[model samples]
Target: MQPNEIAEVLNRPLSQELLARDLTRLAYVATDGTPRTVPIAFVWNGTEIVMCTTTNAPKLPALRHNPAVALTIDTEVHPPKILLIRGRAELDLVQGIPDEYLQMNGSYEMTPEQRVVWEAEVRSLYDSMVRIVVTPTWAKLIDFETTLPSAVEELVKQRAERQGA
Candidate 1:
């Protein structure tokens, strides 16, 4: 997809909901040449998707070796809102806690006292974290209303041709 097309899909209201969502399934190739998909927390900053992980995360090595990745963000409803993305992972190791991490988890409900405790624990446990940043090269949004899957579109085309013939 062209950059403008990707941006248009991502800027749609339904896509915005997916971007606001807390989790996305991150898909990448592992070191053993196997595909791995894991549910991970993410924060989309309009231009990029940022996911924080431990400095020594297993995915880090795989991402470093092969930067290509895909992500799926969707809903569990009947007419699910789906967002598919393809991008390259750029790992940035930041000292101390990443603010994006905190902001991404901020939506979860917690008592003020619990929040403080959680922050302390997170701060004490990790000295640094790896931010996996993905700048989308391609994207598609399927809300099943304004848009349909490519396969569905093709099926519709065949049906119309047969009727006309």
Candidate 2:
């Protein structure tokens, strides 16, 4: 899809809400030529999705070999609101822990003092991290009310045709 079209989907209210969510299931190709999908934390800056992980993270190697990725973010409620995104991952090795890492974990409940201690531990442990950035090449929002899956839409059309006959 064109950049403008992707942006249009991303700007929808449901998309915006999904972007605010902390968890996203990232799908990528593993070295063995198999598919891999894992739940991870992410921060969506208006333009791109940022995911931070340890430099030695297993997924980092896989991502480096295959930068192409797909992300799914959705609500758990019935007739779930889902945001599907396809993008290429850009891996950046940043010195020290990235601020985005802390920001992405901000929603997790923790006392102020606990946060301080956690930050200290993190600062001391990781000297560098990999920031996985993805710029959306395509995006779609499925809220079930206004939009239905491709299969469902086809079924609806078939049903309507039979009913009319």
Candidate 3:
């Protein structure tokens, strides 16, 4: 997909809301050639989705082997709004905690007192971090109210034909 196409889907109001969401399910090919999906916190910086993880994380090896990835950000309402993104992962190893790490984790709810403890724990745990940067190559927004997945759209047509047959 062209850059304009990616922007067109993600720039919509519903897509923007989903992009602001705290958790996105990331799917990628594992090092063992298996598919893996995990819920992770991410921050959208207008153009890219940034996530942080430990330098020695198991997922890092898989990501290094296969950069292609998919992300799903959605709401849990009756008629959910979903934003689907396909991208390539760019790994950056940083000496100190990256800003994206803090930003992505900011959505976790915590009392002021608890937050202080949490921050302290985070500070003590890891001396280095890795930033996973994803630049969307393709995108789809499905509101159910307004749109549907491309494959589903095709499936609906097929069903109609079968019914007529």
Candidate 4:
């Protein structure tokens, strides 16, 4: 999709709401050519989706080899609202903890004291991290109220033609 079109899809209110969600299912290809999907915390910084992981994460090597990826953020309720994004991952190896990692994980419910302990543990555990950044090249928002999957939309059209006949 064109950049403008992708932006249009992402700018919708439903899409914005989904973007604020704490986790996204990141789908990518493993080095062995197998597809993998893992739920990971992420932050959407208007233009990019940022996810952080330890330097030794198994996915890092796979991502380095093949950067193409897709992300799905959705509601668990019936008539689910889903935001789909396709992008290329750009890996940034940074020393120390990245602020985006903290921000991405900030939405979890935690008491102030618990949060302090968690931060301390995280700081002690990782000396460096890899930032997986993706600038969306395509996007789609599907809210059953206003939009349906392409196949479903086609079925609806066929049903209308049959009824009209």
Candidate 5:
């Protein structure tokens, strides 16, 4: 999709709500050829979704093998609002701790003292970190009340035609 078209979808109210969500499920193909999805902390940087992981993370190998990925951010309530995105991963490896990682984890329930301890422990444990960057190529917002997946929209149209016939 063109960038502006994607921007339109991302600008929608439902999409805005999903983007505000703290956790997103990242789906990618594993090296072993299996599909894997993991819940990850993410920050939407207007034009891209940025995520961070340990340098030696197991998923790193898989991501290296295949950069294509999908992400889903949604809520648990009824008439859920979902934002689905497709993108290619761009990895940036960095030494020492990263500010983005700390920012991503900040939304979780943690006291100021706990957060201080957590940051210190993370810095001591990881020699380096990897930032996974993805510039969304496609975006869809599915709100049962306001929108549906494109495929579902087509199916609904087809069913309506059959009924009319």
Candidate 6:
């Protein structure tokens, strides 16, 4: 999709709401030529989707080999609202904790004391991290209201034709 078209899809109010969600299913091609999808915490920074991982993460090698990836963020309710994004992952190694990591995981329900301890544990566990940044090249939002899966949309059109016949 064109950059402006992707931006237009992502700029919708429903898309913005989906972007605020904390977890996204990241899909990528593993080194073994198989597909892999994992649920990971992420933060959407208006223009990009940022996910942090350990320096020695297993997915790192696969991503290094093939940066192309897809992400899905959606609601769990019936007639789910979904935001789909495709992009190339750019890995940036950073020293110390990244603020984005903290912000991404902050949505979890936690007491102040729990939060402090969690931060301490995280700080002790990792000296550095890799930030996987993806600036979307394509995007789609499916609310089942204003938009829908392509197959479903086709089915709706076929039904309309049949009814009109």
Pick by lDDT: 4 or 6, better one:
6
User: What TM-score fits each model?
Assistant: 0.96, 0.96, 0.92, 0.97, 0.93, 0.97
For candidate 6, the clash count comes to 0
Highest lDDT: give the candidate number: 6
Position 89, candidate 2: lDDT: 98
Put down candidate 5 lDDT per residue, 58-112, tens digits, no spaces. Answer: 8899998999999999889887778899999999998986677878888889999
lDDT of 3 by residue, 1-165 (tens): 999989999999888989888999999999889999999999999999999999998999999989999999988887888899999999999887788887777788888888789878888897989989999999999987678878888998899999995
Worst 10 residues of 1 by lDDT: 103-112
RMSD in order of candidates: 1.2, 1.2, 2.1, 0.9, 1.5, 0.9
Q: Which stretches of candidate 2 lie over 4 Å from their true place?
A: none
RMSD value for candidate 5: 1.5
**Global fold similarity of model 6 (TM-score):** 0.97
Q: After superposition, how far is residue 100 of candidate 4 from its true place, in Å?
A: 0.5
Error of 3 at 33 (Å): 0.7
Number of backbone collisions per candidate: 0, 0, 0, 0, 0, 0
Q: Higher-lDDT candidate among 2 and 6?
A: 6
CA lDDT, candidate 5, residue 40: 95
Of 2 and 6, the candidate ahead on TM-score is: 6
Winner by TM-score between candidate 4 and candidate 1? 4
Give the C-alpha miss distance for residue 30 in model 3, angstroms: 0.8
